[model samples]
Target chain A: MRPVEVGHRGGERAPRSTRLLGRHELPIACEADIVLVRRKARSLAQAYGFDAFATAAITTAASELARNCWVHGGGGAAVVEELYDGTRHGLAMEFRDTGPGIGDVEWALAGGHSTTRSLGLGLSGSRRLVDEFALETARGEGTTVRIVKWKRF
Target chain B: MSPIPILRIGTTLLCSVHVELDDALAERLQEDVLGTIERTGATGLVVDISGLETVDSYVARILADTGRMARLMGADTVLAGMRPEVAATLVRMGFPLEGVRAALDLDHGLALLAHGRSGATEGRRPGRTAP
Candidate 1:
């Protein structure tokens, strides 16, 4: 998929930033994919001067989301993007799955909640780890979770 | 990978696992431990967990499965020398260690086993000489 410009204002006075940042897509296959996603997220975050803790958190969050995709969704893909203005800025990730969508988003976001016998900290912990988190799901359609973390450096 | 050392003293077998007990190692541990129980006719087995850094769900499940498999083979399995952090993680993750024993170290575990075996034998035959 092509990267679309978002967060643009509808005014002629505002200058339009046309810089395209890095984008990556990876397939979630098995439990090992979780670790791979974490590593990839860490590298992307570190490349943008994000603090070590922030990078570690992003890595853990990515691992959680990727694991959910593998275990619950059967398989999915992850998209990562780095955004910048001047000094290294922020990173965002989108995880999309074709598995059965969540029936209760609110309940699922609560900590220690899980349908399977997992640690039940996937979505909740991931949400807490990032600066911004959003989820969209439709019954039988699919689920998409988006998260963004800003650089502390 | 080096084979986990197994020491058989009478009816009990002491196993020293010198590796991480993560998902990958858990698979190998299950196979090796279960296979040992089947072949050696051990009545009890002790698994050393001092080398593990963490116990995730997969490894926890493997430990539980190993216990069940040992029982099926007529052997009881106990976990020994779990690091405090690993124990805390397992507890937080709600992995039950019902039939497994957690000891502070290998020496302590061996001593406990020795005491239990001697006590059991003394109870069985009061006048017999202690081996």
Candidate 2:
């Protein structure tokens, strides 16, 4: 097992021996898509042997991000994948959108800040529910959010 | 998509949410519950979420807002049957579901409604009975 290093941005890099086991891409065009994405994440996490608590966290985080993609990002796609290291299994999800993008990511992640009529808990809350969280965005260029949840032994 | 079903029992409205609720459907539930309360004059609203696998911030807001609205329309709302994992995630998401009452199961929810009604007539209990 390779040592895990926590990046300065609070994101953790997958171990050097990590290998992709499977991948699924889902579209987030509307609210219904959020349910599909969330269910897919739930089943994947359960299949990966994540406990009930971890599975719930995974699905909830996926739901929040997917909702953000549909409501704030104006639509996007989610890529869910399973990764296996020499010693542990992990689930990685990436949400990407080409919408208006975020001008103030820091404020967005600060919590309780929303562009639309929402609770503004999407970015900050989703990050707190996962093991690894990273966000990439540019004004007028869209946004991408990546999260990884490692199975606990 | 079809809206969540609401059943009326006596003076209470029972809404069992079993499927995943999209934003539109969730909004529809709010309108439907309020409309039913107005028409039937339901004195209590009990929302059963036991079958829900997840309750994100958006859905949480809808539930809380629905409860608050029901109160304004002369009805007490009780959210019941939240899974433990779902409750943990909602806490992590920072939605404490303030201004709303919750019970452990459907039976408990109905009991709370009954207690509120009895307390309303007695005018002494501290439950959510109409003044």
Candidate 3:
């Protein structure tokens, strides 16, 4: 019922230092929420001075990652962060879920190999679009996927 | 808010999916397309995604599934007007448009369904392009 009941405890330290912008959340319960994530991520990337292709890549990756959080991970949350590593600015997203975690990390990221009749590009496609990507998960434990896309000078 | 508009253009059902597709909207569309097929005996369906440049995997699945569902009920489905960037994103993402009969443009989708209404070549699956 309460999709976004995760309490907006968004702003934290560490990432705030390198991530020089505000934090936004995408409360994923249903499909429409996925759309919201895409738009929000795109806008954040634009605000950080990413180009057209970079913007598209960011939004597209956001959409896929958010969908995975909701669809495969049994409804979770997405956090978008504006990052700046001093010289270059960037965008980072963290996807978290309490659902069943992935079994094989390698298999899941192999592209077009979904067990749920999906296009199977969520993990691999998203990784390719961004500058950095990391995944942490166990079978019973939840999953957390963090990705970052930095703007080019 | 009104559901996505399903326009009756001649004997074909034209659905322009320009809005950001949520799960509920996609399900509603599936139901409407199938219901319209039975209600109007329409021979073809065209879902225009030209206006939409971004979509997730779930949205793509819904479109593909909608096409497959329409086929079972004797109606052909043609997904039309995907931007090049969107197409590139989809391919790069590894989400195949399985079971989707595609047209590069809306007019092509309409033509593909209009002239090729045999309902016999449903299994073969040939793509169409607008002239």
Candidate 4:
């Protein structure tokens, strides 16, 4: 059996940006992977000169989204990309999975409603931690969440 | 793998989290802590998290639950040594540290625990010098 894949596939264009400084791909198959994702995001953000608060925020967002992929999505892939678009620098991450998709996007994003008895802050809190947030999912297909945090001058 | 060590000091237990914990490790730490409390009959737990870089919702939940569970077992819990940025992120995420006392550092945490142990119904200790 072939392993599931995510992020930018062949024929799918990369993110619209003038230059991508760095890119990394990681597979999220277990709880340890979530910790790795956070570390990867933190190092990348620090390398890109993110402030301490921004770095913490980025890493927290990565941890939350990666956990979603592992817990709700039943494992997936994460792609972290550093972006430089003319005047601004940014870090973007995409968490994708081929597992059962979320049935109610609204309810999931509402916060405090969880299937795993958690605080249910993963989706809602992650959205607030980043500068840009986008989620795409189909009930029977899969779910993909993308988030970006921009470096401030 | 060895479980996170919980050191006993007098009637208190000190558990310092030095690494980022996944769910399994966090659960293990929880069980170890509770079991230690049961065996030692400790009345206070000080969880030092200065080594942790980030306290996400999951880690935050584990800390909160540990505090609550310790309370149920007749123990007071003090969360110590949180980084400033981590604290800011936690507040922004709106995940409050429920039922746990917050201290600036390990010394303050220990002092608070000591105060709680000695002063069940007494007023503040005058000319109090940190132990």
Candidate 5:
């Protein structure tokens, strides 16, 4: 018999790679979506071999980002990806929305900053949970948040 | 997601929660806890959160409100098994949960509730029972 297909048809799995693994587009109308997003993050993190601590951190970060999408953006979607070729094993999360973009990115990134009566730890706290965090927003272009976390010993 | 578990021991109701107590869970928890109190006529409420990973301001408010609700219904509320990290987060978030009775474990909470009930009943009218 021919050699079994052990790896992808192309060849052995690449040592390090990046790919968009999943995307979720849902109306942030109801409260139930919060739970759904959190569960999805946990599943993705587990499938990618994220350690328990990393899993919890990523889940919390996702919660904060998804909450912003719901409360500030009116609604948005998210994409979760794996970036294996980075300095370390990495997971990248992107949340995008078409609502009114934040005017003061610096102020918003400051700890204890929130437009709503939230805990006021959204952006800063989430940033602390990851290795790299970036935010991009424009007056009419909406907002996007990208976060990356590396696997650690 | 799995729902939190509610346990009944005598007239006390113990609720063990495992998820982050955000706005969504807080709203759902308020309804469920209140409904259980009403249905069972529980005399005490104990909320155990040792399994919780995080909590926000809204959740702290909800928990305080739950305690207040239980008190108004003639039941005492005690918070049990709050993890250190969760407690630190609450403090940093500026949520005041100090007045609510907190215990190190469920057994300790139950004992405290039992003692409080006994103390309330001491030297009281023979025909009346402490709530």
Candidate 6:
């Protein structure tokens, strides 16, 4: 579903607690899909009242995670949503794929590591851009990565 | 899939990445760039990323690798027109961008490439002087 676009003018609905606002699902299959995810992320972040710089950060993080899903996990889907925690709002992105799972979580997140031919910064770099990051994977069950970038004051 | 365009200007080959880059497109870009340099005998290459609103570490690595690849092919690579926010994001993400020379604009990029070419020429011919 599309995010509810409330204007910057106050008195709409204050997100009193952490909650999911809207969600968009995109299949991560090809290069084009990567661009699509980034686009969705920018708009979602903006709709949630994130500034340009904050929107950029959210887009970058989303792009990295989505690309990782496609490149490493063969293919998957991304869920883009607006989130709020009290007065602080945020953008949340989650990617899930069914492919060979990461053999070493520590190595993957440590920095300068990649199972495929990459700079090995997809996971690590994404973590650096956002306020929260979590990854889950099993040998055959697939992989899931969730990241959140809170809007800055 | 259409590859990003790499334009040839004077002795400098300019590549402006206007679209979001993916792994396959980036690989094709590298190949196309190397091929163009070989065919045109260009001595300089400039990669402009100002059109990109955001870039991830993978794209950053590709740019850096392309710079190194161009250097290996006897051409100097100059990156130009990166947005400040994008640069900051890359830095925060810890993308070292090793061996990539950056300039603020296309004109400065061309100048940097020209200067590097002249330096290389001078080094190749120890006694040669600019006329």
Candidate 4 displacement at residue A4 in angstroms: 23
In terms of lDDT, which candidate is stronger, 5 or 6?
Answer: 6
Name the candidate, 1 or 3, with the larger DockQ value.
3
RMSD of 1: 9.8
Write one digit per residue (lDDT tens) for candidate 1, span B18-104: 754434556777887777777888888788878764445545667777878887898766677877655654554344567665557
lDDT of 2 by residue, B22-117 (tens): 778788989999999999999999999999888888888999999999999999998989999999988887775777788888987887788777
User: Which 10 consecutive residues of model 6 chain B have the lowest summed lDDT?
Assistant: B120-129
Q: TM-score of model 3, chain A?
A: 0.86
User: How well is each residue in A105-145 modelled by candidate 3, as lDDT tens digits?
Assistant: 77787776877746687888887777778787866677888
The DockQ for candidate 4, computed on C-alphas, is 0.61
lDDT-better candidate, 2 vs 5: 2
Q: What lDDT tens digits, residue by residue, belong to model 5 across residues A27-124? A: 45556676677677778788878776677677777777888877888777877776675434567777877888878777776667657856566776
Task: Please give the distance, in angstroms, between residue B91's alpha carbon in candidate 1 and its true position after superposition.
Answer: 2.7
Best by lDDT: 2
**Order of candidate numbers by DockQ, starting with the best:** 2, 4, 6, 3, 5, 1
Q: What is the lDDT of residue B91 in candidate 1?
A: 53
Predicted candidate 4 versus true structure: per-residue lDDT over A20-68, tens digit per residue: 8888999999888999999999999888899999999999999999999
Off by over 4 Å in 1: A1-27, A35-66, A77-96, A104-136, A144-153, B1-10, B18-25, B118-131
Give model 3's DockQ, 2 decimals: 0.37
Output the TM-score of candidate 1.
0.57
Report lDDT (Cα) of residue A138, candidate 6. 75
Please state the Cα-based DockQ of model 1 relative to the true two-chain complex: 0.08
TM-score for each predicted model, relative to the true structure: 0.57, 0.89, 0.79, 0.88, 0.67, 0.84
lDDT of 1 by residue, A34-81 (tens): 666767897887777766456656766786788787788888999988
lDDT for A72 in candidate 3 is 87
Better of 2 and 5 by TM-score: 2
Error of 1 at B89 (Å): 2.5
